[model samples]
Target: MSDGHPFRGNWVARMYERVRKCGYDSLTAFAEARPTASLEELADELGPDDIAAVQVFSGLVAEAERSGKVTRLVRGQLVRELAENLPDGWPAVLDDEVRFAVAEALGFWSAYTPETHKERVKQARAALRATPPPPGWRPLGPDDELLLTLLPDEEV
Candidate 1:
C-alpha cells in the first residue's frame, strides 16, 4: 500500500534520522513497534526508498557482536595460558615494580579484578627487576587513541 504521504524515498531514512537525533536502540524499538511488518515492509509503508541503511545497521550489529566475542575468547585464552606459564611463586620471583609492569603489558586485567591484578603486577615487577624481561618491552601509549577515533560509526 502506498504511504499516503507524498514523500517518495524509503521511510528508513526517517528512521535513520530519528536514530541520529535520538539513538539507535530507540529507533530500533520504534521500528519494531510496527511488529506486523519487517524492515522492508516498514520502509515501504513509511516511504523509505531504499533498504541500505537497515541492511548496513543489521550487518554492523552482527559484526560487532562477532568480533567482540572472538576477541574476548582469544584474550581470555592468552591470559589463562600466560598465568599458567609463569614460574612458581610468580609474584615473589618478580619484583613489585616489574610485576605491575608485566600485568599492564598483559592487558587482560581491565575487568572487575583490575586492582588485584595491579597489585600482583607490582609484586611481579619487584621480582622481575633482578632478571628483567628481554629488552623490547615498553609502555603502550596515546597514539592508539587515533586508531580508536578512526573506527567507523554504525548507522541505519
Candidate 2:
C-alpha cells in the first residue's frame, strides 16, 4: 500500500492532465454553475478521510488565492502572515470558528462586481480559446453537479 498521501502521484498527475486538457476556464465555469452544491458532501461520498484532506487542501488554496499569494497578488505580506498564522497550513490555520470565517471571506470574493466578473469571463474564454480541448472529452454535462460544486465558490 502507498504511504502518507491518499492520492497517488499518478492520480494527481491524471487530474492535472485532465484539468489542463479540459481548459481551466471551462473547468472553472463548469465548477461554478451550482452554487448550492457541497464539496464536502461529494468528498464524503467518496470517503470521509479523503474529504477531510481535500477540505484542508482547498482551504489552503482559497486562503492563498485571497491573500493574492497564489494569483500573483501581494506576495510578501500574505506569505509571512499566512505562514505565521498557520504553520501547519490551513487545517491548523484556525479552529472551527476561524475556519468558517475564512471560508466566508473567500466566498465573498467570488461575487465580484458585474464589470469585474465580465472581465474574468472574458479572460477565461480567451484562455480556453488558446488551449484546445482534448480528444474524446465532451463539454461539461448539465448534470455535472459534483464538478460544479468544487469551485473556489462551489466545490468540484
Candidate 3:
C-alpha cells in the first residue's frame, strides 16, 4: 500500500478494521448512516489511501447477504448513485443531460446489484426510466417512499 493504492493485503480485514475505526460495527450501518454518500466518499472517509470503494461495497454486500437485507442494500446503493449522478435531483425534463445522468446512476447501481436481486433491480430501474420520478426528486434514504413503492421488501 506504500505505492498509494487502495487494494492490498487481506482486503476483508483491512476494510472491516477501517469500518470499525470509523465507529461503525457493520458496514451497512455506516453506509446507511450516510445514505446518499457515494462509495468513493465512504471509502475516502474510511481511508483514502488504504480503502477502495469496491472494498466498502464488497463488505456491504457480504453483510447484507448474511443478514437477509440485500434489497435494502441495493436500494441504498441507488440512493448513493442518484446523489452522485443527479446532484440536481431528477431533471425537469428527459433531455440529453438527464438521460446521461440517469444512465450513469442506473448503470452504477446495476453494477453494484447482487446476482440474486439483479432481475428485480433491473425491473425497478426500467420502471423508473419508463415513468420517471417527479422533477427535483431526490431520495434521502433507502426507505424513501417512492423507492419502497418501486421495490418493496420481499425477503421473508
Candidate 4:
C-alpha cells in the first residue's frame, strides 16, 4: 500500500479514469455503492498495483470540497472508520473496553479529516460522545439522520 499514492502520472486523473471505468462518474459514487468498505478496499477495487487508500480519500475529499459537501464526506468517513474498526457495529454497552474501541474509531476518523474541517469534526465527535447514540447506532451512510442532526451542512 503506497502511503501517498506514489504512482507516476496524474494519479488523480488515473483515479477518476478507473472510477469511470467502474461505471461511476465520481469516486463518491463508487464509494457510496459500497459505503462500508474500508479505504483500502476501495483502493484495491480501483487499482491494487498503483492506487492507494490515501489516494482514494484524496480524490474523494477534492470532489467533496468542490461540491461543498465536506460535511457529508466527514460523516461518511466516520461510517467507514467505524465499519472497519468496529465490525460488529457500535456495541450495546459503553463499558471502558468498549469506550476504547469507540475512541479508536473516532480517532482514525479525526486523523483522516481534512484540515479545514478538523475543528468541525472535533465538535461532532464531542457531540456524539455526549449524546451517545442509542445502544447500537451504526450509520450505513452519510445521510444517517443523527449525523445530519449533529453536523448539518454548513455550506448551504
For model 4, residues 1-156, the per-residue Cα lDDT tens digits are 234444777788888888999999989999999999999999999888889899899988999999999989998999999988778877888788888989999999999999989998999899987778876778999989988997788885
RMSD of 1: 18.3
Pairs with backbone N, CA or C atoms under 3 Å apart (clashes), candidate 4: none
Clashes of each: 26, 6, 0, 0
lDDT of each: 0.37, 0.34, 0.88, 0.88
Report the candidate with higher lDDT, 1 versus 3.
3
Ranking by TM-score: 3, 4, 2, 1
Candidate 2's residue-wise lDDT over 1-156, tens digit each? 223343744434433344355454322332334222234432343344422325323543554455443331111112223333333433423468755643443333332212324444344334433542232222232233321222123221
How do the candidates rank by lDDT, highest first? Answer: 3, 4, 1, 2
Task: Point out the higher-scoring one by lDDT: 1 or 4.
Answer: 4
* Backbone steric clashes in candidate 3, count: 0
Summarize candidate 1's per-residue lDDT along 18-129 as a digit string, tens digits: 4555444544344434432333444454344443334433432344355443222222222332333342313444567646645653443232122313454444435444
What's the TM for model 2?
Answer: 0.25
TM-score, every prediction:
0.23, 0.25, 0.94, 0.90
Top candidate by TM-score: 3
| TM-score of model 1 vs. true structure | 0.23
